[model samples]
Target: MQFQPIYYDGELLLPKIELHMASCQAIGIVTDVKRKQLLMDQLVDHSNYYLFQAQQAEYMRLTVEELITFLNKITERNERVTSLMDYFALKEERKVKIKDLSPSKRMYVTLMRVFFAHQPTLVLEEPYFYLEEQDRRQLKRILEDLSKEKQILILTSNLEDAMISCDVIYRLNEFGFYPLDIRDSEEDKQEVLEQDQANITIQKISTKRNEKVILFNPPEIDYIESIEGSILVHVGGENYDCALTLTELEHRLLNFGFFRCHRSYIVNLQKVREIITWTKNSYSLRLNTDQDAVVPLSRSKLQELKALLNI
Candidate 1:
């Protein structure tokens, strides 16, 4: 006895192909080198004229190397090219290994989706996966920078990083997409106010007379020194001890006139009375209060701060 085989003929297959092509168009698919070559081969196959026509009508094939070269030519900075190259490397590595791509590449692809997709809204899940601490910070900066260009929707479980990076945050509970928090300049101001209130409470508790406070409001603070995990906020004539870590203080006071000039210090921008070029790679910040502090500036941030201050 012969067995009959289940089959999908041209009628059924055409609809499936159309649906797949539409899905691919919606999401902006990126094919690896092998898949791209296979697509091209199928497009040129005389036996599958329908597939060939579909490929020609729906998509274009380009090598990752060619795409990198094109991007390098149009991009202005060496850093952008470096980032693109890193992404290309990871893409190739993933093809060879058939495993998870590097976090940097994943970030790059997500960014590309945002750039190329027609939709104004995009969502990213677990974006920080496989990234180093420094890379994660860089990714946050990149995302923050990109937000100026487009509205992004990110779904992340990392609360601290999300707080640092997002303007508005939401949580998924039984109620669905609850607005958990909104952090903007106002939040930053409230944080500063709460910090000041806490400081007042501490002073009242300790009765420290020489403890400092801000007499006149400044545009920005350059750096605050960290002593034994506590931040020393230098204002008019004295140092005010605050029970905040240097990073936390920087985040809280950044909108109020503080900038992270070093890992251990955050400075007031308006209080930067003068900047002494300490060396080719470093500088010293002189405050309006006649106090000087040395802070290490990375080459990139040094240029950025100079442009920001117009110094």
Candidate 2:
């Protein structure tokens, strides 16, 4: 399916997207809630798409096995409920009512619709967000197996969640949708390298907002982000377009208590209030800000950050 470009008051919101999803690949799009809703709005009215939203409603009175049986009956799938329950690792909770399971387990049960969806494309929103590690593993395994038969598209706000199951990942923001390089292999890292060049000293960052140029001192900035290859200067609670590249910004901000926390993010160490470990490798830096700002921290950089802060 093809999606035309979307614009808002002369600014580009979403670029034209052409989907080719028949390669047994599960595509993941990491985006904010509003954009995810925008994409969902376009697919919700279509019959060829099965949209599994984050807050999907379930029959609270029905048991897990009953719900699976019902879905199989309605979808005309002949898969044995007992077999599916075992495959889903829900045999222990098979007799438990939907409302009785833990929040994580309940969400996992709600995510079972993907297995029975008749639509040509399965669009799942944050399927792993509320799931526990075991449930997450089960879902990832299920999604991988399902990808061979249907077009599976995952939409989530977390890159780490997307990385869990998706074969191909894309980042969608106001700038445009672009593929992200989340590969851990050194070969993939080398593919993204640029030729080394001399850097110049910079004190203030120049950004553009509403056709007006705004200059912010290095100390005033909270973090710098790279979205779709566009540098954005984030200050206070707002972001402005920056002409400089992330590498350039890194060089400029290197001496201002800033750390390259992730491949796409740079954070001011002075503002880092907490190091939130989602997993041993997946982590985030919570900033000491009023709006509860957080940034992704790469596992490869964790040791570097520890040394920088003497932690």
Candidate 3:
């Protein structure tokens, strides 16, 4: 059925609105505050019955608070009386409420619509554009969770982001939108294997101080801390005190995951718990032990560190 036109800023309705209007028997248009009132005024004076009928289906444009209230009302109605449940079960679900949904919640709602409503065609526009990395990962998981339930059209400009999550990608180029690439997610397993191989070159430098002291495996070394011109190697369980300068340690462990982050300290590439800015010219490294190491990060080193960490 035709859904209410939900407009953001009144500039345009999402492209899916037109498709829904063509397929559904009824239509509802939801627009923002001033635009909704303007549309309501136009509909009141218009004699076009078809337009008015469509406008009548326009459920009130709900604010975030109002949407919460409406959801509460639905739950209350469902719990209150058996007749209300029966009626709701018999009728086509007519309610459409849009609010500022968290990334996880939005994915959950999309999956619910795909499964319960049997919506054959679904369109999402940069749904995770504003989400943080962790939240984006959760949303990606939800998309994978619902992959078999419906046909989805996702519009995004980030090819790498899309490739990580989507099976079939249609890229928009100067020529026009086309299926630029189709990837079997199954093949992604092989890509991960290649990534593991890429990391295989990180050599393991044995720490020697009167005896052979091997730090934990490459991944277990969170980062190295340099203090008083000496580099301290941080591993999974303990810190290895080394007698090498930050530069010397960087030279020796460069093939491994050691990077020079500051003048006082060169850090183990893997042991970096967090990077903290003490000031514009200075920064400190927070280790896995929760101790803060003040280190001077040059502009060049900051950029290099970002690239190394993929941040």
Candidate 4:
């Protein structure tokens, strides 16, 4: 997808990273706060070539149902508000006022409305900020659905968020946007393979419940998550404290389908029913267990997880 060389205030912004309008979802990681703001202005503000500014773009100005009715009157194409609500998991908060809604919730409704109006492009600034893990996953799915016909540009300082949502990614800097390395290097791949083959035995894991130690098989554990320096193991719809850290367990259980999905979580891929979109920055893997457990997924590991799941 080659784009015409684009310039912003006499600086090159495109062709360094080509963006096509055919269902393209692109993300730019700008760690520098100043650069991120500058890039946002360049992408979201109107230009000679890209005239649709973010503020001028369509967004939710009314309730979900009302917005749908309004769209039905203006556009020739009919879009269902019920479906949009379901897609964004807004069924529970359908009646909530826009002011009463949380930041993440408001963002979800904004995204739904923007896409329902069939806007050709969406320019978002730090879209994943403060989003919960579950909402992040839903937003990812929504962007994917919208990308079939619309272009999405996400600007954020979080690299993982960019990796999760964008088809083509770049880093914003003083020079311009530069393509980022998303693939594991050859040496790193070899190291992963060697690590995968070397240790396959993790017969049992020890955990304490109420200060009583219990042992469980590696296969019996659904997932392991670490929160705030404390490691917890999930098995049989229960959580127990494990002596081993997430890193230690991830290495021991690699052959057992346990993969590091996030910095705080290692999941048994075989138990994952589906990947839940939390936001553009975060993800969740829903387990097929009795409790329907979910594990955190990091943006940086998005491709690795997809490859592992064969998605």
- Predicted model with the maximum lDDT: 2
Expressed as tens digits, the lDDT of each residue in 52-86 for candidate 1 is 11111110233344444444454433336446546
Worst 10 residues of 2 by lDDT: 183-192
* TM-score of every prediction relative to native: 0.30, 0.71, 0.29, 0.49
Per-prediction tally of clashes:
14, 0, 17, 10
lDDT of 3: 0.43
Q: What's the lDDT for candidate 1?
A: 0.42
lDDT by candidate, in order shown? 0.42, 0.83, 0.43, 0.65
Residue 236 of model 4: what lDDT?
80
Record all residue pairs in model 2 with backbone atoms less than 3 Å apart, i.e. clashing: none
Better of 2 and 4 by TM-score: 2
Candidate 1 lDDT score at position 132: 59
User: Model 3 over residues 14-39: C-alpha lDDT tens digits?
Assistant: 22222222222111222233433433
Tell how far residue 220 is off in model 2, in angstroms: 4.4
Error of 2 at 106 (Å): 2.4
- Regions of candidate 3 where Cα sits further than 4 Å from its true position: 1-118, 182-311
Question: Please, what's the RMSD in Å of model 2?
Answer: 4.8
Could you arrange the candidates by lDDT from highest to lowest? 2, 4, 3, 1
Candidate 4, residues 27-66, lDDT tens digits: the string is 4454466655544445533422232222333344566556
On TM-score, the leading prediction is 2
Q: Can you give the lDDT of residue 114 in candidate 4?
A: 49
